[model samples]
Target: MTVLSSSSSRFPYAKGSDGTRRLGYGADYNPEQWPREVWEEDVRLMREAGVNIVSLAIFSWARLQPTAETWEFGWLDDVMDLLHAGGIGVDLATATASPPPWLTAAHPEILPVTASGATVWPGARQHWRPTSPVFRDHALRLVRKLASRYADHPALVAWHVNNELGCHNVYDYSDDAARAFRVWLRRRYEHLDALNHAWATAFWSQRYSDWEQILPPRLAASHPNPTQQLDFKRFSSDALKNHLRAERDILRELTPHTPVTTNFMVMGGTKGMDYADWADEVDFVANDHYVVHGPRDEGARDRDELSFSANLTGALARRRPWFLMEHSTSAVNWQPVNLPKKFGELARDSLLHVAHGADAVCFFQWRQSAAGAEKYHSAMVPHAGADSDVFRSVVELGRTLEALAPLAGSEREPARVAVLFDWDSWWAAEHDSHPTARLDYHTEALAWYAALLRLGVRADVVPAHGTELDGYDLVIAPVLHMVPQTLAKRLTRYVETGGHLVTTYFSGIVDEHDHVWLGGHPGALRELLGIRIEEFGPLADEDTVGVDAGPAGELTGDLWSDRVDVTAPDVEVLARYRTGTYAARPAVTRRAAGRGTAAYVSTRLGVDGLAALLPELLAPAGVTSELPECARGAVEPVVRRDADHRYLFLVNRTDTPVDVPGVEGEVLAGPAVRADGRLSLPPRAVAVLRGPNR
Candidate 1:
């Protein structure tokens, strides 16, 4: 057996007697949904599946707290004892993710209300208003009770704060929300005059004379104030964070030794919670990701969403190994068309996360649900029971995880390039009023990332606000719409100190409050990139213009075009629009400042355009593919290094088998090696190879 050592000293869990940290494998175990007779069977199957950890009591608030005064622990005690006796640890949840129907019935004001004055009824989950004092008090009481009861339990390993906070009711425009929003505004702006200035409330006679009159960004005749809407989003995320902190405090006070975390929905379209802000509150990070199916082509749908999500989650964990808190065993029920994983896809998807930096591989559930909104959702033990192929795959995956136990604490190797992902920018960029309604933040960021993956280059997806830029050789901020002054200075200093930067159109247009920065477009970065945008020319869906790069050839860009003017003599036009009203303007400009270089893109270059342009953009920074010559562009290689070993994860996202030659190493996991020195990865397969650090 190979011994794997961690690069980070902040490993949260203890090591086994063999000096290797076993990779945790389990699912969201809700034994309360089953009979007491079924609980022991669940434990038996868990041990058989090498399930060492299970997240318990995630949505059991109704069962745990039957009424306002009644508290029941007999069933919970039995389940916890059974799990512990079966040698499985528990990520004990506070069960505050959903309040009981009785509680909501007793306190009707706790229900979340939409901007249209529609109350989110109790038929669905996560219907409680985050800002309601009634809800908070009841939630905290239950959390205190759970903590006090289970603080010394042997099964407890970590405290699961709340199930995917703000998943549904992130924003509540009720009177309670209005009150909390006012209090939040008062704390943020200090006075009504400052609030007026920040929100630019002078427009349309909307100037606020009193804080009490201010309301949540509810329905208006026209569009609401953009700044007010932005602040309301901020307050909504903060409100959920406050709830988490309220529960986290109780858990920490009672169980100081146990770590606390909540599952973050870090997929493409999830925008409710700003996870970067939430990451600091957790002891370790965990994320739930499912395949994003859309009107997109099949290949595009399967194009490594899991890897992208896990990489972002790992970056949120500060490059430490984070937990794969929840994913489906096969197809998910929520998408327009739910599709099952093809052969070998389950292991492929699971290992892809491990390749990024997942220490655990868990799922949404242990057993298939017989009823509920997610009855058809896939699970470890599927609807077909223990004899099913899903169960076999689950058992096989558990064995594979045990084989890869030495990789539990390993971290991904530091990358020379990083892609900036900011929630503030996401919120601000996608506002009702923007240059282009078609502008998607994650799509643009993923375009850059997918290009890098195609070139077999590993890149960190970091938040633009709080991340340190000194470590990276090249930084790319795609559609960074909201740029605070501090971040602007940091980027300036980073470029001044010789780090390369690439920012796209609609970037740096506003400050933290969605207030447009004066001077010119691409606000604070105009001086660094040596370009001033006079106006934005948004293209229609059918409209596209050609940008002629000298050697990279003509690239077609759409959605947005900025009329750029070169401010300095040293600013070189790398690409220019070949047609359209802004034909002669620079589509892409590069400038050398002090010892660094900055490139400004004036349009949204789709994936193909970026694939053509990135090589030229990254060449000056001396960033190259880490994969072998034969594997470059064919197999996706992610390198993670420790003191003794270099783990290379090669994932074949294509439909055909890829032969990656000139690779010499011991196959740690995945497909078997060919007769030659090449690694043969089948379609949707993954290869984890370990070798000495070269």
Candidate 2:
């Protein structure tokens, strides 16, 4: 079940083949915004902070071309030369996602049309029509210009196209987009009959007899129709990918050797461009996550701080290291509560990504923001320059990394635990006419992930199709709806061999074709789960039920509750709901198979319930939580080992002191704890604990 055991030192860049230093820093340096004279001082400061890389040309569309049909590269050319002289490599950007304002005005087709029927004007970026041929022609031209200009530059490391795609959701239902979508759909279905079948358009009598009869799913007239909406989402994503594919092809052909990738948005809930598909074309994955110190909803701040970002990046790239493309070094202006990172919090946050598997770490801006939307976001240098406390912290962290290069590229080789998360289930299940709109796939998956994270177990967040169940000792399918048949057979065989399985509600409900697998609930998984879902009880927004006994005790949350009849001979009821007409019904059940067990939870539970359940699951495997009472909002660090050495990651997730046991040296902030055993940690710190293998 072991994946790969390379001497991590050989893979320092996370680019096993690129042979470049993988660990570095990120900053949007618009030297144009700063005087040329300030460039040297900034470079010196960056080098002092252990900064080795810079993502340049972001938001420089206007600077590159102030007017239509004109080009200007004087400022960027100097910036690249200065950074290169300082030993800082650049992630060359195409600046394509955003078009200059004049281009949008000259070609009105570039602007996006909202689902509400209003045409959006230019000012913000990513506002162009993805399918507009004019937009594609114009954008691709600029990408080629940048590629040709910098392709051979010694400072160039990777090619970053645009900044973030789909920053604005949905676009131009103009005649051009409509025309393109018709052709796209025709190509996909080959015939109107097949298209109608996939869309289930037969129910609405919206069948198209001719290819021209199909129109781009727009919000104005045929909007809000679930079938059309889903199609629009799919088409929009494909359209965006087509744009990305065009640029990817250009970069691949021109540069060919240097890796190319774009930063993906955090928790981007299926806007349509499959990152996994994009990952196939690009060399590796890079992502940005900006979680501020504030509450957006009822969820805890820590939820977004660690789990959400981890899940997003983890989902995008499972086997390889993903670059942390951008994060605020201090408070972000966008959040209502712009509280700055308390002492060690930032460093701890950085380590969490590495512990989970980040190849490199960097901040949004090395120097302070001068103007624009992100002007208020914190940076390594405050407007006050080198005198800032934040800058000093950056220096300290840099020194720490300098001391730990010997451990460079080493990864956390974790235990065999696979949690199947799929974007299809996320997109399709939400579009369902189900009884409850609260049945969120990501939330359900996170609930299960949170439980596993607490046990100090390293689990790989993988797609159902990509993972082989035999490689894992435990397979958790959280809210799995669209079960791939090939995946179903693998899971069937795993449980038959007695491997542990923990599944939740709404699993095994649909197949790859988005059709229900009927019999009872869960289709093909019914026999393995050994239960038939008679009915599901939808809990009111404010209502809740508690489970106080079973393998775990005292579980409570407002989730979709269900009633089930156990059919397997070895099944036993572990916990029951404590409310309503269905009170005393089994909420948690476990069944014995050949060499292991299968557990099912019919409703959502609170932290207490998870605390009880995870220990029981890990007990048989002889794994235990190393830091049982990690500081509130702090993530517990996990330690892993091989034949030669033991690796421990001290992930500090809190904005306050998160003291933890056992630390000899760290990649950042040297000698975290003395041998005296007084575990002391700074806020947001990442202490890499290493010692001889036992």
| TM-score for each predicted model, relative to the true structure | 0.96, 0.90
Cα deviation of 228 in candidate 2 (Å)?
4.4
Give one digit per residue, the lDDT tens place, for model 2 in 1-694: 4332222121125432345334666566666678778888988888788787788887777789888778998778888888888888888888886787788878987787765567888766677888888988888888888888888888888888777777674455777777888887778778888877776777657877887876666654432445455566667777777777798889988988877877776642433555554555456667777764434452444533365455446545544466777876778787677888767656656656666556677778778768877788888787777887888877876666555444445545545677777666777778746758888776677666666665555566666655456767787788887786876777777887868888887788877656677788767678877888866787889888776566565678576777878889888787887775467887777777767777787877744466567666655445555464554236556453435666676665544666665345433333357665546666555667677776
Pairs in clash, predicted candidate 1: none
Instruction: Summarize candidate 1's per-residue lDDT along 500-567 as a digit string, tens digits.
Output: 99999999899877788898888977888898998899999999999998788999989999999999
C-alpha local distance difference test of each model: 0.85, 0.69
Can you tell me which runs of candidate 1 are displaced by over 4 Å?
1-14, 17-19, 296-298, 672-676
Among residues 3 or more apart in sequence or in different chains, the pairs in candidate 2 whose N, CA or C atoms overlap within 3 Å are 13-22, 113-172, 344-683, 344-684, 345-683, 345-684, 347-684, 348-684, 348-685
User: Any idea how many clashes model 2 has?
Assistant: 9
Compute the lDDT for candidate 1.
0.85
Q: In candidate 2, which residue ranges exceed 4 Å CA deviation?
A: 1-22, 170-174, 220-228, 268-273, 292-308, 311-315, 593-596, 617-623, 626-635, 638-646, 654-673, 676-679, 692-694
